[model samples]
Target: MTAITQLSPRLLWQFFDTLCSIPHPSGHEAAVRQWITDWAQERGLVTIQDTIGNLIIRKAPTPGMEQRTGVILQAHMDMVPQANADVDHDFTKDPIQPYIEDGWVRARGTTLGADNGIGLAACLAVLADDKVQHGPLEVLLTVDEESGMTGAFGLAPGMLQGKILLNTDSEQDGDVYMGCAGGVDANITLPYQAESVPSDHQALRLNISGLRGGHSGININEGRASANKLLAELLNEINKLQAGIRLSEVSGGTLRNAIAREASALLTLPKSANPALAELITARQQQYQQEFNGVDDFIDLELVSADLPQRVMTSDLQQKLTQALLACPHGMMAASRDIADVVESSSNLGVINTETEHIYVQCLIRSLNDTGRDRVANATAAVFNLAGADCEFDGAYPGWQPDPQSAIMQLVLNTHKELFDLVPNVKVIHAGLECGLFKAIYPEWDMVSFGPTIQGAHSPDERVHIEAVSRFWQLLVRVLRQIPEDKAASFK
Candidate 1:
């Protein structure tokens, strides 16, 4: 076992250290779930685990705070599993290696899991603390937040009694997220037909990697390069050069919500055009670097000679795929006309793959409003149809419309200002949150989200700012103590 040094908010550190010792990857959170149950059992706390492994632990109000209202502290239990390719970390069994570096706590070569883990730790720390002054509290921890929101979606109605919900899942500190964008997955599959290989052709592989990829929701508007798009652009350039190349195989991107960081294509080209093809690809790489100099400094493109045992995509299909992807709109499509810093709608060309029988592409569409989301989805499907690619739209989750005048919102704002002597920044986030699901299930519940500063979530670059934990801890306690016992509310 690696020794972990305790940090501020001693209970928080203790809980965080214990959390890191368990393997809690998305869709595989049995060990962590059992650990949490065991911890609650040992404490003799009132706890309940739902059918889908959503745990709810209720803590009675402190003596002086009994008059205050009930508050639900919510956070997802699962973390996105990511690690450096060179690392031998196993998501199913190996414990996360967490250590302090430069003012942040991070995992060695793997995702830090600070995204929701810290929120989970904070809830546990508050639950275990006997001295913290607060009203009735219920800590709600759901599973599979990374891969899907199954646990959240499966939450039974009336499972929680708190009228006010404080979701500790935001990444930025000092900011209160009142609303978030709704998103849907666009899954596509294209049939493949093999063509005869030319005897004068040579196989080559093209790769685009080392781009600074981030969470597709938060970083989608940053103008950072997308590996899927870059690869398609490269192929389009090759096609434009009239290189007689047949696409063999192509695949890129991992998670739907994460920007593609790497992509590769296997192709066969005429041996006679190999020299010219090499020069053209080299020039294209240089041009791409210059074009993305402002955002992607580490981007790299490489081509290697290879031997192919069988043909991949037919020439006609290759041209169609290239044109389809080139036409797909990526990055920020429109900025909000009302809010100064809000992104109204965006699309992420998340994944592209070429299989033995078909070409596949997946896109994630997000918008602050349902109308805009549908428009983006329809536009994307039209692009694929034009290129002879089949498309399918999965059920989309709804966005949480912000309620600025909610009673709980004012209470939190007042408490925040009193505790920190500064007003917290309240706004809607472009990313998807489980709050939307919760709202769907319980329409009357009032909700708001806030958290410590966590950088690079859902990627190996994830880290938790050490200093923000204490402040977050204090803020949570303050908000709990200030909630009014009785409040009437209505949905607008």
Candidate 2:
């Protein structure tokens, strides 16, 4: 057993350690799902799999606690698969090699999957141990939460019997989340005309790297630079110089929910323009460094020689696409008036790629209300549409509105204060959570999201605090036992 399995909360850490051995990246969850089902069955818990592949496990109430309101512990089953550009690890076949660093547990060269893995571990720990007090309980493990909230969106009505849900997905250890932002995916496709590269032109690749690309929703307000936008800006500057550069290919970012950290472009230009292009790259890199000073510590730009490509995008197409990319808005757009110091609306220019017939772009827009989200979505679409690209919005989900008079929220607040001698922060997150979707399906269900302190989520730098997990478990255990009985109906 690893040292992590020997943490204070042994069962939770052990389960998390085992999870690190499995490959459960978004949309490829069968192996991990089957493992969880088999493990639950071995423990004799009642397990059910919904049509959308969401898993539900049930445990009867503790003897005298049967009269309390039924509670559901919720978390997602998938993790975002991200790695540093130089990391050679394959997420599908290799285990995430986790090790202790200072006081946190982190993977060697890839994402640690602790965002929901720790939450899932907590649920399993509760199920396997009978010592914890609770009323009727259900554990809901949803799928594909990182790429898309497919499991939550397709959740059928009346599948769960819980009136209260405790979401274990929030990242901050001492904060209790009451609401979250809604989101939509804006997909843009631009068809381009291609022509044979001139025989006299030489090929060069412009590479952008070393930016701290983080969660598009959580870190969008931090003023981090987007590699896609940076590349487009550089290309636009090149066009102004009348350098006769022809774009052959461009690609950036990995997931739609992560800010573009790295991007590269291939181009063909006359050998005579090489020296000027090199000088321009160095000057642009220095400008970016000064502009993004403390936010993105390392901003690198390089021009390297490459083999000439057979075809290049028509000059008109190249100019139009780069201009559209530059015009698309990114980062925080507005601050919330209702909640102090919180972002109300934002968008991320998450991804861009060149394909054989066309180039594709993806942007994620987030807002606490439908109007703000649609406004940003419309503006983004308008930019690309004017450039002759087709735009479509998909997988839109509603935001969770806060309830001022929630009984469970008060109960959680009181329980935490009593147990820890410190009141937890009751706040709303700008990031999208499945709880918002759950609110639509089960409007009467009172929900709260809480978890341990996780830093650098949705990136290779992801890690979880060791001390925070113990405290998180303590709070969850106490809250489960203090749940009040239902006054309107008799407990089943």
lDDT of 2 by residue, 384-451 (tens): 99999999999999999998777788888888889889889999999999999999999989898899
Tens-digit lDDT track of model 1 for 139-159: 999988776788887999989
True-structure RMSD for candidate 2: 2.0
Off by over 4 Å in 2: 487-492
> What TM-score number comes out for model 2?
0.98
Q: Whole-model lDDT, candidate 1?
A: 0.84
After the best TM-score superposition of candidate 1, give how far the Cα of residue 320 lies from its true spot, in angstroms: 1.1
**Backbone atom clashes (below 3 Å) for every candidate:** 1, 0
Tell me the whole-model lDDT of each prediction, alpha carbons only. 0.84, 0.92
Candidate 2: residue pairs that collide? none
Q: Which candidate is the best by lDDT?
A: 2
